[model samples]
Target: MSLRTRLTLLFTAIVSILLALFCGLLYGVAEQYRLREFHARLQAEATTAGHLLLGQERISLNLYKLMDRNQLTVLPDEELIIYNAQNRLVYESGTDYLALTPETLTRIRNEGKVVWREATREIVGILFTDQQRPYIIVASAVDTYGVRTVASLAQLLGIGWCVMTGLMLIAGRFFAGRMLKPISQINQRIDTITATSLSSRLPEGSQGDELTQLARRFNRMLNRLEEAFKLQRSFVSHASHELRTPLTAITGQLEVSLLAEDEPDELRATLRSVLDDVRGLNRMTNGLLELAKASMDASAVPMGPVQLDALLTQIQAKIQQLQPDYTIHLRIDPPDTHASDWQLTGSEALLRTAFFNLLDNGGKFSPDHTVWMQLIRQGTELQVTIHNTGVPIAPDQLPTIFSPFLRGRNANGHTGHGLGLALTERIIQLHQGQIRVDSSAEAGTTFTVSLPG
Candidate 1:
């Protein structure tokens, strides 16, 4: 069932049940009141009959019968009888006369009053005392008018219940539909939000309801999607441009060698040029693959405790071996000589790549071809600082240093695709670490990396 329909049915059922209970309670109370009123009338008739028999001297039975036939002191469907001390019937009025029992007589003599009831009929017996004898007066009746009133009340309650239940159903369905209107709107909006329209945001209402919060979250997700789309477009464009350069160079060189096949020297030079272009393409492809691997979340990357001091020693040796003319001085500091602050959980190869990139960047740019490195323990954190006495990167370009394919304007002779720092950033983020760089002409450039131990 639709939510609105179900809500309406539930409300109708609840109202119907409550109305039934209320009507039942009213009926019971009214029935009791009607019975009490009938009892009072029967009692009054009995008292009057007793008074008449006791007050008058030798009253005639015929006169009492006349009084009843005239309907002066008797009501319809009612009977009043007087019993003598010997349990003999002395007088009676009305129809359906109740036969007095010995048990009833004994009860009247002992208690002064006796009552009996069956279905809608009620009978009351009272013992009356006189100067010469004691007698009993009994009255019995059914309240026909009260019964009719109860039937009318039941009919009215049934009608009221039906009308009220109908009204509740209508109201409940309307309210339920109104409450779900916002969700319906949101669904419609979501339907229109596809990849082509990711820039479009979800509607955020001012009421600050749950629906509003949901819309806000959807809008935020759309923003991220839009950013990813732009980045993917840029990445594909740059990658294609970088790849086409090498292929074009290789093709041009091969065409030149084919056209000038007679000279052995020209053929060798052309092949070497083509080989260099091929090597550049391979290096770019490798860098792109590494960037992709580093971009994954930390949980997706394999992790292990790497000895920071050992890794630094290895990187220092590799850099020294690569650039025999360049000097790379490495220093380590801890609170104690044997402290375990050098150990941290991360991807060792990725971490090594990040450090090697910084070291390479420093050495490549240094006019003196010297890089100074230091690892220091600060509380629960370890910091590695790499300083180069090279040309300083422009101050304005610092913010965009870690952006993909972004290079400093001051970099003139550097041949790089600009993915090193960006890859380093991704790997550091995967390791839950931070990397920052500071550079100036007078003080040179320094790269600092901080990781938790």
Candidate 2:
């Protein structure tokens, strides 16, 4: 069933049950009042019969019988019976509907008064005394008027209960629809949003309710999606242009060499030029692959404790081996702790690649071919700084320095595909660390990295 229907049924069912209980209670009280009132009337009739038949101021037996015959009775189906102390019947209203027993008479004499029922008839018995002699009076009757009143009340209550239940059901359905109208509007608005219309935002009302919060969250997600789309477009455009350059150079050189039959030395020179271009192309391809790998979800990368001091030492040795003329100085400033303090949680290979790129850049951009590296322990963080004497980067280029395929004016004579810094930044971010760079004429160029220790 739909939510609105279910809500309506549940609301109606609860109120209906309470109403039924109230109607039943009212009927019971009315019935009990009718029975008590009728019993009182029967007792009065019994006392009156006793006084007239057995009291000192007695009425003639023949006169009382005449009065009863002339329609002077107090109740319908009324009967009266009187007995003296000798157990002899003295007077009767002339009715055979009620039969008195020895046990019943004894009870009435001992208790002084008693009342009981037999099917639809109510009976009352009382003790009477005149001149120190005892007598018993019994009266029986059916309450015809009271019974009709109670029956009519029951019929009325049943009809009212049914009518109220139906009205409540209708009211419940109308209110439930009003409560769900906001969600219906939200669904319609969501349908209008598509990939091409990421800028289209949901209307967030001033009401500080949960629905308004939901709309704000959706708008924030759309903002992130739009940013990602722009980055992807830029990445593809830059990669295509970079890849085509070296390939075109190699093709042109070979075509020209084949057209003219040059000497062996000239042909060898042309072939070597082509070989150099191919190597540069291969390096650029490898950088692009590494950059893509670093951009993946951080949870997918395997993690373990890596010693930053040891990883940096390895990078320094590897860089020097590749470029023998480059010089690297490494130093660590420990804070009175154990060797384990240098360890942090991350993917070791990725961290090593990140440090290698930073150290290589420091030496490549410096005039003296020298790079200085330092590690310091500060509270719960480990900070590393790499400094090199070089031409300072322009202030306008700081913001986009880590973006893919972006280079600065100081990078004119450098041999790189401009993917190294971007890959390094991504790897550090995957390890939940931060990397920042500062360059100026007074301090040369320096890169700082911070990681959880």
Q: Give the winner by lDDT.
A: 2
Ten contiguous residues minimizing lDDT sum, candidate 1: 333-342
- lDDT by residue (1-453, candidate 1, tens digit) is 876678778878887899889989998998889778878888888887777766556466778777767875456578888888988888777475466668878898899887778777788888887776798888888777888998899889889888988888888888888877888888898898888888777779899989899889888988888988988888888788888988998998788777765588777878888888888888888899999999876678889889889998999899888888778888887536664568898889999999999998888888877899999988888899999978888988999888777788756798788888989988888888899999998899999999988
lDDT for position 410 in model 1: 59
lDDT of all predictions: 0.84, 0.89
lDDT of 2 by residue, 97-128 (tens): 79889899999999999989899988988898
Q: Estimate each model's TM-score.
A: 0.73, 0.73
TM-score of candidate 1 against the unseen true structure: 0.73
Query: Cα deviation of 197 in candidate 2 (Å)?
Result: 1.7
Model 2, runs deviating above 4 Å: 1-169
